[model samples]
Target: MERVEPKTADDAGARADAYAAGPLLNCLIREVAEPRPDQDGRRVYRLPGGGRLLRVRAGRRPAEPEVYAAGGWRRVDHAELVKLVSDELRRHTGRANDELPAEMIDSRETLAALLAARDAATAPDDPYLRSEQCLVTGHPCHPAPKARGGGPAASWLPYAPEAHARFPLALLGVRADAVVEEGDTSALDALGEAPPGYRLLPAHPWQLDLAAPALAAAFADGRLIRLGATRHDVRPTAAIRTVHAPAPGGDVFLKFSLDVRITNDVRRLWRHDLLRLRRTDAAAAAAVAAADGPAAWLSDRGYRTAAFAFEHLAVVVRDGLREHLRPGATALLAAALAEGFDGNPLDALSGPAVWWPAYLRQVAPPALGAFADHGVVLEAHLQNSLIAVDADGMPVQALFRDAEGVKLLPEVSRSAGLLPEVSRSAGWERLVYCLLVNHLCEIAGALTERFPAYDPWPAVRAELARCPLPEIGDLLTSPTLPGKTNLLLRWTGADGAAARYLPLPNPLAGG
Candidate 1:
């Protein structure tokens, strides 16, 4: 909620110090091998690694503050900061308590405390400068620093100095019924050439914001998406994108789905399908009973979701390197997402819950009897997860998509009296496929290639060792199937580099 601005090098430095309040052990200024100068007489310090920098710039809360990068400086404004920080904290903490209490505080308060500690540890003898300080080089912006890249791209194009910026919500004007075709003309080129109505303008958050509508209209009467005449058909990238507006420092993505119907979709899908279908709710309650447990461990951590909307989701804009990450990081991330859950285990001795058993346990008559006879559950497989990473190139958060293939647990046998047999059978089929073929294979496969040092399944076993249910840990390490499964990857191709399937234990051996 607080915005800090500093005009001179000294002022910026002072603000940074105040923000840090102490030197951060995890934070270090990475001096770009070569420094670049900015238009407004500032030195851009590009820190490649370590924690985030509490950057402050001259001006009244600049719309987008200039960010220090290797190439030079880029604009990342206040709005951008809010979105980047908010999304990251949410994903890392995996809980949504935006307003951190003085006690058990995690996100915002954690950041504030870290900053304060960093400021308090600053060296008093450090050289003073009229301009702000740079952690990487331990220097201030020198007049006439060498120029870096061609002057920033034209406003129409996107740029990011930090990891946060705006992206074009280009709503091209196309017929309501028209479908998007490949190789359509470039929307960017067309917008630059067009005049007046055809001109491309940056999308405004308010312009797209909407409140939840009547029950029937939200889903039953939703409008078909109409294409724009000059639309760019680009899907979101695994890597976060950074965009800039004409303004000095532009806003970041801050969208809120005001539609309650949309929010309800999230609840039904996550709470009912994933949580309830697999008995995670029961497991959660159980863990709370048996001293500190996984569910209890993650109890009060996460980001914020503003007011409820009928059907809504929000996005933030940021500027950072968008590239393939290191293999080690990918493995760590994939395992984190899996949370030790596997469809099959190799060793019967290990005691973690198998995917099938969890489903069966959750679908017992007592659990399903409460829902209206018509309620359905969706099974979440690997493909459905969309992971968002932070600066370290690690996955700390995930989004589960695809809702049509919902179903019931297999244990729930259907009787023709109240519920239709077809609905029950269909639900069971979806659950089996999702758990066995879809979620299990994809995640295990990725882990095999990503991490060769230690078995990913075994690592999951290690984490579960601390769980309240040690028997569940034993089940996890045990193989559910009779023989070796051809699941591990074998390096193949001309250079024997491509990966192919090989046989490995079903679940890891020994609990």
Candidate 2:
């Protein structure tokens, strides 16, 4: 087991502080701070509202933060950094968020705790599992990525996927009369036998714990029965709420309702979202299937939830990677590729010349084809996308998951319409942000970090150029791309899922 404990010299606090500062600094730089003249090696940025000068060792991961104070620069630790951010946001936005400041602190502390726990915790042998467990930073741009509903550490630490936690799902027997289901959820039936007139419903135990009091009446009235845990434990993927389990019929993945707020939304199988999962998943799957390559969609098979505990007990079955992956290829989480792991293919890259294009070829066309031909604007973000690689660590296929994040066009289906879905323009903006800014930018940053001599974007331009999609015309020529403003959004107390964009220089239109 590769235990990822913090090094003795850095200590837990220092590692967590550095990890915490990166996202915060990135957010500050992107949303509020304006770049000043570079002084020596320190990249200095001035806050617009107060003309406050902040300097840091800049790169993909900024560090050694300092704020200009008195006459010289004063060091700002993580805690002080949060205070600095809160004060600036209040000045910049003309609004003060009582909650976000605390969340910023909580996020940092949570990372520290996760670092200590992961260091002591034994890593899973499965490289995929290790990759899934590797998102200790979670969201790269969120102000409070790790705030687990602002609850106690004990509540979330035990089930944290980042700590390499794996446990069996809590099973419940819903009375046949009370079981509400859609599509093919027969997969749940094979998990465990539910006495004579009961249907098996798997629930995230943490969710069960959160919703237990509400379910007391149902349990008492025999509407639901406690059927114990699954025989085999399921490993949580990077999504945290979704878990991967190896079953008799190959491998299967299950996504569960988690009441806690993860990054953007409450990590629940929301009643409305669940009601439409089948239709959304079907649209995405068909779009991917229509594309002429190894690209695949991990279909959200179906869901089963008790009528009374509709949102609380919901569980959606997702297709496993085994059937979709090409022979002799293994799938790795794309975010893991960006954040790095024990064996990230990006780390071993000799140069970007060969590696970059192969990646673009495997990743770009499917997403472009889906939008151009199939009206499916995939949330092709880092976390939702996976890259399957061959024996030589070359990307051979691109597999995307999470139908919940997917957007469908009005033309895609009017009768079975995903009504109230984002507009085509809105959807395209999201796709550009998710696909280009969030997904490709990080990977490019990673590759460029190692092979700075080689420019990765000309090849990105060429790969995207290969796509016959007309939108590529503007995209390749566009001067600016939309960058999501997380710091400003949270500071303004806007909904996390709600996007606010700022113009970013388009790398495709290189100097």
Candidate 3:
């Protein structure tokens, strides 16, 4: 990919600041601050730790952040905002974090680079590809969603989905004796051929580069052999490590272990997760099959890797859209629908009344149904979801992927030796957070942004009421919803898997 300079350094910096500040402000307000009366069309929040008043031009994306200083309110740019947040969090949590603030800065810098690169790069002709690559302001609630491991722009920009990148996979041959795999990974052999004693393995070039040092001895020995790159180019999806591979028979997705910290964790296909993948994937597939709708589960069929470098080089083969998608319906990332994109179906709608209901009918049922009927809990957040729309741009089907995040209620507890009650409680909380808070809220906000008069919560409540789950009644009347505390979680240096949530005012309560 080639790059051109932004219109001006100042303009790019300001835009990056605006982009970075929104999520940080959202985190600050949601996790700690107390809401105050509106001031001059801006929402005022009191930072309890410092007794300081902060205000922002509030909406789906908050902007123009200002803090009440010695006398009057003063504007804070991204850098200053980071400082303010760090101070407030330090006071609020009584914890010190040097790393998060750096990531906050890195995220802004990364955004600026992405903004410039996106201007120069050509978007893919495929609408799905465009939607996958369209998340410039990713994970609207994360404090540093754009942070690229705090690495140099050149190091990551080539493989960045936001840059509209597509590249051939780096092929390698693992010695047959060293190859360890589970389930159906026939897709790997189709990528390229290996010598008589070796099996074909495809690797992400970026991950290959990152893991080169660890695999130096393996390369020196007969365990690993380098084959050339694949003939076909794979486009990186919103989940940066996963790529959409177009094949002669049908398109497939390849997910590789990326040794980078994306949002909450280092996005490596861990050995433990891989070992249990088949069970979790099988459970999710069964749940989807039993669900009452056209909703599909894009199963992670299998994975292949060298036993020596399992986590570093593991590649998961996932089901593609062709077989599951209904004819004439276009499948798009749900995240892309929330984060506007060119050729977005949502943009074509005149109002949210028709589109929102159709969307709810398609998306809400499968997720809720799977949990109620089956013991499977899906990580059905925006990125993991795909909403297939018909000719008129109304949602017709819902497709979800990422089995690595799926949890089976009693099964997970039995296998992991955890308390059944604890497992079930945690699983339900995660489902609620991912589905209601992270996914539905975002899509609803997007619809509300366009149709100001349209209140989406009533439709959401009605849809939940339709579900047979006994939990629905309490959920509809709950005073608060679980909102993941990403900022606080990172600040406290907790493991990414250890999710902590803060109670957020529930809109469904009124409905």
Candidate 4:
């Protein structure tokens, strides 16, 4: 285990506190806390349930947590902040979660360890890889976004993307007779060779270690054989389960099933999802393929795993960014761009006049087109979308990934007028949330943060108006847009896939 020096440990804790505070503050503002007018150039919010006045250095990543108490404001560090959040959540939800509060603290500690480890780890030279690995504050809204199931630092630190870790895949040979795979998983064969009677199956080393006990029997029975690691190192992207492996011409990416939970749910590529993977992937791929211009889909090619181990060892192969990205354009994680990254182009953009509209052009068309023409509601959230920018730091192309989140028309059950005031169907509402609220709002906010003079919503409204889809008119005129209430959903212990949303101000309404 690599030890953090005393001085480094102290620095790490302080830095981690700020990085960890962003998501927690976002949750509080969105759910439990009501924001008051700016007070003395600082953001002030009333914690309704706790009846405490909280103030912070405002903006996207709110920091310097302070609570007003006994007529004097006192600072709260990450530990105390977690306790406050726990108390507030308990009062607000009228429910207590023993596991969640600890997880929040562990997430902060994990950030500290990641900060310590990143000092030693070398970052990738590729800009795309840098953008992918650059999310120190992973998810902008999740309470414990970086918590790796509260495991020891030694277990997950080496595999942490935030630390810029790169490692080779652990190759395993499953007996040919027991090999189970679907779609175009032929890509797996090229990773490494297997013995005459076996097939090549690359496993995530961390996952392999976690599943060792379950896989021991298969190893002993000669159903699975250890085939050592891959030839080259694969770097983890923002989604820790997915990795980028360099290859000739264009690179190939692989996503593995890890049992440990990340932001939400167990990150395992479930069996049911795998079975329907082809249909979902094809829908997204076809949707993008049909769209005009530079919009692309990084297709989920296929997956390979052992029949005996199944979900425990499954690995899904996805098309690399290089294959889909426009020539001379650099692809970046949309979320990293939204939340500031190391070399973020948003920081470089002179104003929103050119950049914001260019971004809207790249991101919106395909999503709306897919819904209108192909009946595919793409989960076009920040993490799933990649913005490929030109030399001028202007978005030139939009590349989308992940088929697991795609909701096809046939499968979408429309429930209208469920909520008394909302007249829109559920499917349309979800599309609006994923495309507008989740993806566009943060991006537009980032642009607005940089260029406060420009209101990016008109351009957003303009882009949607250009789309021929029937929903555009109503969307532009609607009074409210659905925003996913992640904090409440998680607190209520709902299934992660089960989305619950609340009404938010419609930026398109010109309010």
Candidate 4 lDDT over 1-511, as tens digits, reads: 0111233345878788878887888877777788888887888999988689999887666777899999988989888888898889889889988778877888999998998898788878887888898888877778888989888999998898889989999999999999888888877888889999999999999999999999999999999999999999999989899999977677899999999878768899999888878777887798888998789999998888888888999999999877777889999999888756667898776677988888889999998888888777888998999999989888999999999887766532222111122223666788898889888988877777777788888888888999998877888888988977767777777888888887788988953
Q: What is the C-alpha RMSD of each candidate to the true structure, in Å?
A: 22.7, 2.2, 2.9, 4.5
Higher-scoring candidate on TM-score, 3 or 4: 3
Instruction: Mark the regions of model 1 whose C-alpha exceeds 4 Å error after superposition.
Output: 1-378, 409-451, 463-478, 481-505
CA lDDT, every model vs. true structure: 0.27, 0.85, 0.90, 0.84
Candidate 2 overall lDDT versus native: 0.85
Best by lDDT: 3
TM-score of 1: 0.25
Those runs of model 3 whose alpha carbons end farther than 4 Å from true positions after fitting are 1-10, 411-422
Clashes of 1: 75
lDDT of 1 by residue, 325-440 (tens): 22232211122233222111211213223432332222222112211132333333443333333334333332232222333333322421122313543443343334433444
lDDT of 2 by residue, 2-53 (tens): 1222255358888888788888888899888899999879999998878889
Q: In terms of TM-score, how similar is model 2 to the real structure? A: 0.97
What lDDT is obtained when candidate 3 is compared to the true structure? 0.90
What is the TM-score (0 to 1) of candidate 4? 0.93
